[model samples]
Target: MDLDLAAVRAFVAVADDRYFGDAAAGLGISQQAVSKRVAKLEADLGTALLRRTPNGAEPTEDGASFLVQARALIALADQAVDLVRSRHRALRVGVLGTRIASAETVRAFHETVPDVGVEMLRSEGLADALTALARGTIDAFFGRALGDLGGIEARPVYLEPVHVLVGRGHPFAALDGVPIADLAGRSLWVPGAVRPETEWADFYRVLAAEFGVRVDTTGPNFGVDDLVERTAASPELITGVGEKIRVPWHRGVVQIPVVEPSPCYPWSLLWHPRNRHPVLPELVAFTREGFRPYRPGRDWIPEPDRPAFTA
Candidate 1:
């Protein structure tokens, strides 16, 4: 008998949720549709897969064993689709912002595998970047690696220092650079709870506590323009940003390097482990072999030998 892939997916969903209604919700289909699909699968296999309980549906003895096989089949099906689609000559890489410092990497990748088309997809933060990778919207991404990357593989690229963004002509802007400790009593504008998609908020908060940088947590979805304007208006208010971040010249803002215990931001390249694109492995290998880790300059001060920011 022919086992349907759709029915297998429905069965796995139901098994995972332990309820037809919840599984249908997840699949974005009706409860009856999911029930019918699962029923058809059970009939084809000649087994009663699920038994209804007061709480939800429970898999039977046979179903518990078959679940393992069902998940494996689904994984294989996904891999097959990925492999076939990759043959069309395209690879998309995800970036957090317009300035992700990935130009060198992308150029190197193209030089190594010149035939495959390379495209860039911009995402808001690390979470969105990973989500896009999982959905196959992008083949890989360059960003800070969080602790839990799920099934994705993270390879460290380098460590970037955080720069202090102060309005031009401000008291702190007169000097060449300022120490990280100088931000002890100033207000640093940061995206708070309102901007739920901003993944680097916690990192800033931790840096503030560590180096005595006073951060203003009260804000509602501030963008690059908002940050520049706010800091230009109030000299006392400042912000920390990645060293590679490109801050447009507004004649009101100046990016100053934070010295004497500079905050280090670790960046990594992330890709789904099972992505079957032919050039994917080649691109990863190129970076893994030749990519250089960040080293501080002679004048740079250590972070009191502090830990690196994971996020």
Candidate 2:
């Protein structure tokens, strides 16, 4: 008997939710439509899948067992379609402001895979980058997981710990790594909470709570120039970075580690679920492999006896 995959997906949803109304809502269809589809599935399977109750429906033993197969089939089918679609000629990738800071990653991508059409879309805000990924404007971007990014997929490429960016004259600049408790009333140049998306807006909130750091709100833009300028100009202000910013000429500025901070940049290579470019997998695999257990914050020192990140 020929059975439609749509009917199967609907049936799985019904089984999971245990209510026809919820299944219909999830599928964006009418309740009657859902019942009809499920009924048709039951007819094909030749069994009574659901036993109706006053509160909600419960799947029979057969229905529950069949749900496993149905959900698996739907998921595998979707993945197969996605894999097949990824075989396209050009790979569209979105570069967040932070990844662009690296410069080498961008240049390497082009040099590494010249055939795939590379389009560089600049995003100042993480929310903006994630939005583009969901909206299908761009394939993937470098971002940290925040809020509820439903359709987008994220694969962590590398991690950079939070560091203290201070000016040369600052007292803390001379220290090995400033303790987390020391930042209680310290003026920090922090990324603002009201971001492009409401979901990721709470990341900083959680960070502040965990680190016990009080931050004064700053700009939404992630401009390298702005960061460099802020770190240089503001003696009292410290901008966070994963690694030490050792600018030899900057006599007035310093980038020190924050002893240990919970807020870290897990540089993830994110992409849309539908993007089917072959280069994407290669790029993602390469970066994930290259940066696995990659810690940029841990700097190596020349002296055998001394540890790294000490003045």
Candidate 3:
């Protein structure tokens, strides 16, 4: 309905006092505002909420029914606050990956408080996080560095520069940073390589198109095991993944930095509009502070950290 809290509160006061001037005095507002609100509320609901009689004012049957709802709304609002105060010890959270964040600090904070319960979950990637976010299964997620996140209604927490992953014995593997051209003629193991171009895929193609680089991409993009196998077999093959994926086996695989005008992927903390948890507001603020980027903050990251992308 078009009814507002102000109007509802005014209506309640008027119902209790039964006198416009007295109700106005109790609410600390002018009687005209009270009258106008009543009229607007009635117009919005298409039913008169109050009737003028010789004895001040009285609520009609419809008004009485609405009064019940209004009072219930107010009571529930009060009850919601009470619930927060009483039951905040249990908070369920989803983390994109166990390795994706400064989870230790987050856990420590929750532990210190003793009044909050923090739970975490793992996700496949950004898409997984978004799916969980849409379903209300998880409260937050972190993902790889590409995409414009501005319009997604999320607040970013941290970002690290993108890195290239290649097997250790590969010729270019030992390099501190490889030129974008270094990847030009390589048999690239790219994710979503075999799939038709998506708008999101187009974003990844910017480098290939702009640098006149040709890549041989074929296979599922999500498998790290496959990338490792391809790298072990082909010196020309390489795949890109998030910076957070630490190279576990130094003997076979290594992550070399991308030095020539590289891009950074940001991991974000996103919450739903309806996710109004008791400890969430505090947790989000702390997480933002904890994961805050370096000196330049958002601007410090390498080229084309354009924004977090969503499809």
Q: Local distance difference test, per candidate?
A: 0.74, 0.65, 0.63
Task: Give the alpha carbon lDDT tens digit for every residue of 1-311 in model 1.
Answer: 77899999999999999989999999999999999999999999999989999989988999999999999999999988867977685788887665535645676678877767988777777888878888888888887676577788888765677777787767888877778667787767665323534546656656767666677768665566777777777666677666876666678878888877566666678899877777778778877775444445422223422233222
RMSD of each: 6.8, 10.5, 12.2
Off by over 4 Å in 2: 1-90, 98-104, 114-116, 124-127, 191-201, 218-222, 244-249, 293-311
Best by TM-score: 1
Residue 176 error, candidate 3, Å: 1.5
Question: In terms of lDDT, which candidate is strongest?
Answer: 1
Ranking of candidates on lDDT, top first? 1, 2, 3
TM-score of each: 0.64, 0.56, 0.55
Error of 2 at 27 (Å): 36
Q: Give per-residue lDDT, candidate 2, residue 104.
A: 44
Put down candidate 3 lDDT per residue, 103-130, tens digits, no spaces: 5445656776676677777655556566
Error of 2 at 127 (Å): 4.3
Select the stronger candidate by lDDT from 2 and 3: 2
Provide the lowest-lDDT 10-residue window in model 2: 300-309
Model 3, stretches more than 4 Å misplaced?
A: 1-90, 101-115, 124-135, 144-152, 192-203, 210-217, 290-311
